[model samples]
Target: MAQNDTFNALLLQEGDPRPIAEVSTLNPADLPAGEVLVAVEHSGLNYKDAMILNGLGRLVREYPHVPGIDLAGTVTESSDARYRPGDHVLLTGWHVGERYWGGFAEYARVHGDWLTPMPDTLDARGAMIVGTAGFTAMLAIEALEHGEITPGTGEILVTGASGGVGNLAIALLAALGYRVVAATGRPENARHLEALGARSIVPRGELAERPDRPLLSERWAGVIDSVGGDTLAHALAETQARGVVAACGLAGGAGLTTTVIPFLLRGIRLQGIDSVQYPATDRERVWQRIGDLLPTEVLERCLAKEVGLSQLPQRAEALLAGQIRGRVLVTPTDH
Candidate 1:
């Protein structure tokens, strides 16, 4: 049987540290049972991917696995008629990198249902740059739009504003003409966030130290909250009457210790943003808007680091410590 070059991807064994992806020659035997096999070009590093890499989280139930949740590439073979060879594609979520093989490898074999044909204009690298983090940010923005963010509405607050989703939210909201107040624990990144279009910077200490109150001074009309727990609660207490908050990640903590005053008395609306299992059509629509709204400059501001697959393990630790900002894209071929 003819062999092809096998690509490298980050993998974690059941009980190992300092795990690194290895590149090995591949035969048809290595592919999972799927209708489509795509030659992946770029993959994204997400917080969850870090969790999997460090073996600190339950995301990866098994070992000897690829750990990227987002990938963009071209189709090499497909049994699904909707797809054919040479078509570019992007995959986000779908229990990939957890229950099944993921995009960290040089190739990804996934089911047709889990794949989205890449928008005609976006190539593989560009798409991965907008990977799961940007996708989640766009979804949060979409939820906020439906909640009615207008210029008349006061400033919008973005918690965890230095992270991938938070930064993207700041840029997208600002692009939509809403004043954005970015909150970050790192004072050093104030100007960085500001350049990404945050109208103001609120130190994480200031917001995270908010006193427990039934309601706070109504400071924001809209909020893109990635830091859950007390930060999310404080944001709720301070949301303008009839304002909306989109709660996505739990970077602070999962539990929301909040009173119903914001919802019952002020009529505040809280929308949960989940990108992992979002419907395909909905995902495509968001991708289309991402292609249009996330222009090169905006994307550039978000691209914090680019590391080869060999460098993923250490980078994963940095991400888990919240030491890295913006977004990190992984190129398997950079070795």
Candidate 2:
């Protein structure tokens, strides 16, 4: 493609009360400077993406920004020796959408270091199906294992189980032979959660409120909690002795109001998962593991919907409202 060739992208511009998101046309020259230029095939619609699209968080410092944190595509040009034309790759984190120009466009120019070559088992679309959420889920599981929480230990609880990270966590945990209890506010999604390998469902209300006591009944052997705040506190309170809790998202809230009783008495370990700046040297192995754990069928089962750039503004609103479930894929070329 020529530098002058125009492509479509969802551009975010400053608005009075919120950011204005619309599909705009741009040339390759308009992309931010980087060592590699990729022809983006798929991007994932994540919580962070929604926040950026809606201008909730001050993620983007400048206007006319592209806000897609996760992308999978084929390299079209490269100055970096590690990547070359026609190389399939995937990217997540490194504050791509927040601090830098990101992948909402049909093409993206990014530092070669931010990209990971796609695993042989995963295609561009499948890699995006796993995306940042699935990557974080894998990291959480690894953290739990490091804390000695095995499948045979006991049941595992997945908070925010209807969301992307929680859905993938439940599927991955169950695939690894652990019994999973999914926690969600939407009771209507119980059957859907079960289909994604949740052995049981826990009403969000049961854990949404602050725990009356510092300690609750011992239940989960380990937990992959995507909803922080009261739900995290509740999970900590009910964790079994020596259990591990991987705290990831803050969809519920960021504050944690809990006592140290679970830590001191039950020996619980609260591990924080950050996929954004995860070490690049270790990404390839992790991606391979994700590819192995999440097969095509599992990914398809978890996918909620697929939309184009033109549809993202509305979808972003629905996602933040908690109306969206599972994963939502974005096809930049569709519009």
Structure candidate 1, residue pairs in collision? none
Poorly placed runs, candidate 1 (over 4 Å): 1-5, 16-26
Among all windows of 10 consecutive residues in model 2, the one with the lowest summed lDDT is 55-64
TM-scores of all predicted structures: 0.95, 0.99
lDDT of 1 by residue, 188-252 (tens): 99999999899889988877854578898999988889889888888999899999999999888
What is the C-alpha local distance difference test score of each model?
Answer: 0.83, 0.93
C-alpha positional error of residue 242 in candidate 1 after TM-score superposition, expressed in Å: 0.8
Most TM-score-accurate candidate: 2
How good is model 2 by TM-score?
A: 0.99
Clashes of each: 0, 0
